[model samples]
Target: MDVGDLLGGNAWSYVGGTLLVLWALVWLYRDGLQVDAVADKYVLVTGCDSGFGNLLCKNLDVRGFHVLAACLTEKGADDLRMAAGPRLKTVLLDVSSRDSVQKALEWTTKEVGEAGLWGVVNNAGRSLPMGPSEWMKVEDFHSTLDVNMNGVIAVTMSFLPLIKKARGRIVNVASVLGRVAANGGGYCISKFAVEAFSDCLRRDIHYFGINVSIIEPGFFKTAVTSLEPLEKELQRLWEQLSPEVQASYGDKYLDKYIKVQRLIMNAICDTDISKVTGCMEHALTAAHPRARYSPGWDAKLLWIPLSYMPSCVVDMGLKLVLPRPSKSV
Candidate 1:
């Protein structure tokens, strides 16, 4: 039907319009449901031995994605390989080390041809809540950057050529902390860098049909925020502190902080990670994927607003939530 005829002058115009829209949807859905866009395509996912990375590798493999799972240790590699089955290959990659990164690139290129690689998911990262910024050691902060920020870049660069060739996706596992920072630590800064990098990559690669998306999760029962060592260190610090400092902000303050941490951990543990997995699948599979995905309820309700607020507002809000320091010795 002609455009003018369909506009209002034709008898069957309504029926033609309906049929055209249906046909377009059918065409789009034809290729969209296969979330494993890299099915039979080489995909390298970092930190595949545990947590989100492990789950993603398994999920992708089940959906027919050929996964080159990168683990840090032999035991981790062995476990991943055992669970991943035939389609999943294991490689020991320490993303923080240049030598390890180069080795992984060489091995990946040789094992799966440069043209065969489809996607790279930078899923390995650590979170260290090292008390206040002033209290934390420089090494604590620097090492955090070494792994979270530097490591992601190293892996991304290693596989960029292959990803470009395939016109594939890059899924970066940044945190809600990346977007909002009430909690001051090295981890937050590293995640912020990751988010920035991912955004830059998405813009730069838009013309090339390559997608770069960041997953900003609030808390997902990951090992990054384990409280065991935290508790121990806090106790040790309490013992070492001078009486004046102890009297000024007594055990009550520390107790409150620990309580908050516990509450957060509990909330994270209760979250259903399937929500995140679903988001990851969408990023890899959707014809028109979003630039960023927030995978948890807390991420949406809490961090999203915090992310947009001014620094002073965020600081005030954080102070309100944090338990007041105790004055009793």
Candidate 2:
């Protein structure tokens, strides 16, 4: 066939048009369908003190779902209660602490009762003491892992029975960093653990009619991404380093490290957090929720794609973007 004939809409055009139509239909069917009886369902969201968790709690309350908002502080709980509808209940939870998670679980059990918990959104996490892995101490790693990784595991285990009873959804908040490992410190490591845990949990629990979904959002403006606390934390790490170690890295390395982070965060951080919470909501309410959701343009266009690239390419790109250590050969 002549090229002009194909351009003029021949069998090739028909095939292309048909494929586009089929893609659209599949997209609509996947996103448009939602589960019924949301009013009777209960969804428990952690880290409701602020950010995506807070917004999701408000949105879910407005949608008529019984939203159990878990805040780490009394002020956060009070603030959430004031903003959300009366159907929204608040629980004080510190997911990193075993005792706190247990108490919250008991409270959640009583609140949910026989209907059980319809959804568990593990939105709590920490992202600090982030720099060169060598600059960090074991405690620094644990401090972030305690909240971001162990916290997710503890919360999921505590609520697994309840979720099984309801045969409902488990939505765990990971990050695009989980797939890409584009940063140092425990933040990416913890998220990588979340990705693995979510996958294993999904396979193990699917037989019980439960669905586990992972939310891998790119950077957003939240407490997790705040620069103030990070500045203080990184400074402390630098100061505590032994004299030889400090000399090896040079006095100005810390400045460059923080500056690089600031530049990246400023360039990529999305202020519209609803982009993430909307994916979480869909994971909760969709009749056939996706196993994973990457909820930002950066995640779709950059980080996730980088994760699939050849290791040598990713390493070379990182070497160009990331600062070299003063002690490097």
- For candidate 1, the per-residue lDDT at 39 reads 56
Q: Please, what is the whole-model Cα lDDT of each candidate in the order they appear?
A: 0.80, 0.94
Give lDDT tens digits, candidate 2, residues 1-329: 88887777777778999999999999998878999999999999999999999999999999999999999999999999999889999999999999999999999999999999999999998898888887888998999999999999999999999999999999999999999888778999999999999999999989999999999999899988898888888898898899999889887888898898899889999999999999999999999999999998899999999999999999999899887778878
For candidate 1, lDDT tens digit of each residue in 201-312? 8998889889898999877766666789767755655665677876777657777877888886876553467777778777887777778999888888888877788889
TM-score of each: 0.83, 0.94
RMSD, one per candidate, in order: 6.2, 2.3
Q: Could you tell me which residue pairs clash in candidate 2?
A: none
Displacement of the residue 97 alpha carbon in candidate 1, Å: 0.8
Q: Give the number of the best model, judged by TM-score.
A: 2
Clashing pairs in 1: 250-326
**Regions of model 2 farther than 4 Å from truth:** 1-20
Question: What lDDT does candidate 1 reach at residue 51?
Answer: 81
